[model samples]
Target chain A: MADPGPDDALFVNEVRGGDQKAFEAFYRRHEAVVYRTALALVRDEMTAEEVVTDTFLRAHAARERLDPARSPVPWLQRIAVNLSLNHLRRRRLGIEALPEVAAWPDEAATVPEAAAERRETTAALARGIERLPAQMRAVVVLRFVHDASLAEIAETLECPVGTVKSRLHNALRLLRDDLRRDFETAQPGTQPLAAPDLGEMGESIG
Target chain B: MTGWPDLARFILGRRAGGDPADECAIHRPRLAELVDERALGGTQADDAATTAALDHLWACAECQHEIADLLLVVAGLQRLGGTVNRLEPPPGGWRRLSRRLAAPRPRGALRLRVAGLVVVPILAALLVAPALVRDLGTSAAGAVDAATRDAATVAVPVAVTHAAALQRAFDIGDGAQADPAAQAVEVVPRGPLPDGIEPDGSAFLPGVAVPPMPAVIPQ
Candidate 1:
């Protein structure tokens, strides 16, 4: 017989029945995405863990009404992303901004086939991604990190797609320039233009 | 006179449906124009031109929304674009999926199809692994951050493989148990989301039938 409810829905129902065990089970099942979203947004390990704990707490408190038919990841993400952004805003007001951390998770160990130059390029891009403004960082995370669609990102951020587009493009362009400089610095052999060439001078005179 | 931005916007059109790849190539000339021939010919970046173009790109809000396809290819943006925001999940023994499967599939309106497909199998894999101690079909060298990996390894449980065991841990964990100092914290004053109106899921789950997930989704 086909069970109409999926695993997530079953977990949701179990939690709704006031089973704390099921709730813990629910956290176990979904914590990865929720924590990943938070880490991507906040770029700090400690804060991301805190967000995960808080998200589950809120989920537990609201367990009575969670829709058992749906996957709970989105709800968890909304809460996590919201909390992560709040921390960023709060930190900005009370303290000097921390040196930008890469929005990308470190891949030195994950990418086995990465060549020397590929690793260098990714490092430069990661630095650029970290340096992007917080809001722009959010757009990039939602798009690249979570793989959310443009409209999905807009809905999550409570903004228009145009705004998301602007942020993403600006973010990419900045990364491009940052990567360009990385190459420029890496390529020590290339010489700078020193003097006007006679060929250029004759052409200009003509 | 129509400015560069106005012209670009007219050409790029509005991609509210989220298919932005078609317009990706249009912005390359703009990026290429920024770097000198040396940078173009794989020699060196002209400091003055590269700086000016980057400056213009920063100042130009219009250029910000557009993608340069050539730049994406040459700068290896396509390879990094999908995983840019991804970080390692807290140690729970789940392996990161292959990068190709993990890449964002921007081809269709249903953005979740690819990602959702990637997720379902992982969930199924975990559930089926009655003894989920080892990383499945993945390399052993996954621990990227030594501090976090080493510290969390002993503190957190090895892994929670099933919903059946959701009991013992619950009594010890009701929000306040997270920290001794957090006992006074109040529950967040929020209600459940309205029925059938899930945040990212509403767009796909109800309407499109992902037949594969339904079959393997464990109870």
Candidate 2:
């Protein structure tokens, strides 16, 4: 794991001392992560923006309580995750498509369009991820996007480690099936999709 | 698969190389659980049930298919993770936050200033109270002295008036220096006196004129 960023603890102390400059500096450093994480979960530009704003606001409100010895990123990410989840709950935007596959580019291109195809694959993957259940989507986002550990995700979601693993396992299966269907239908020449494998599972799967 | 970006490894944070778990009726309900354990290879790879499950799954085409599909899904998710553009705040978001921060904090210097505004006057009063009390004491003493002189001036006039009224009632002539004996003798009662009455006693009526004494006394 990367050593906790020095700025997180330092800026936390400065913000606790009522230093706005320090807080602004801190926000500038981490806002992209926070915002991207929210966008990954919510998939709505507006709500994701709200989540980002609320995350920072809450962080500032609780600045004094922050442990300056640790990285504040996880804490901030946790807040963003919670806010995004709550927003989803309030809107009652239940999972869109889980077992059901989302529509993908169903072309029959024979040529290998690497860059354009990758972008298309990435976009379809995002849409597929957004269709997952909120809780499952959170795990996927945290694990893949934020690179959080299982323990960190469990803490953030307030669930057991076993539950996190199960969710991530299920989430990976769902996205994999959806994206594969999209690829197979889109182009006959598309290759087996690759992914970040933290385990020996990747090579075996391929 | 080789040329394709290993998206699953990127998403799962590990390269897939372990044997896939075969389908178990008992583990079928908990396949994801079993698969997750296998996927998180490490000390977990040594677990008995996970090991047994994987050994069996390597021969199971259906379960292998599921694992392969899940890997692709994880890869898609990994790519999805990076798809989002870095977010900038809404227009003027930082400026708004700066404005809020610039406002005086409830518990900050503004609070101290307000406290000072209230306490400074009270402290000044406390500091000056003794001096004010001393000055008031001095002024009060002077006021008492002036009031005493005014009282004496009014009392002297009142006394002179009372003496004049007494002289008129007694028929004492002006410029006559009446002695106490003469004043006492002038008060003799002429009418029939009560049994125990005596002349020149304090019982005599002051304003009543006395008849001259008869040449012969009548019993």
Top-lDDT candidate index? 2
Superposition error at B84 for model 1 (Å):
7.4
RMSD of 1: 26.1
DockQ, per model, reads 0.09, 0.17
lDDT of 1 by residue, A90-177 (tens): 8788763553554455455567777675666666766676667888877766665566677667766778978987777667667766
At residue A113, candidate 1 shows an lDDT of 79
For B1-219, candidate 2 gives per-residue lDDT tens digits of 243454454434323433233124433444456455443432343455555556555666566665655655555454454344323445655665566556655445544554565467656655554443333212342222333323332332322223322433343235434333322212122443333333333324446766655443211
Candidate 1 lDDT for residue B83: 50
Instruction: Give the Å error, residue A93, model 1.
Output: 3.4
For TM-score, the strongest prediction is 2
Q: Can you tell me the DockQ of model 1?
A: 0.09
| Candidate 2 chain A weakest ten by summed lDDT | A102-111
CAPRI rating of model 1? incorrect
Model 2 lDDT vs. the true structure? 0.59
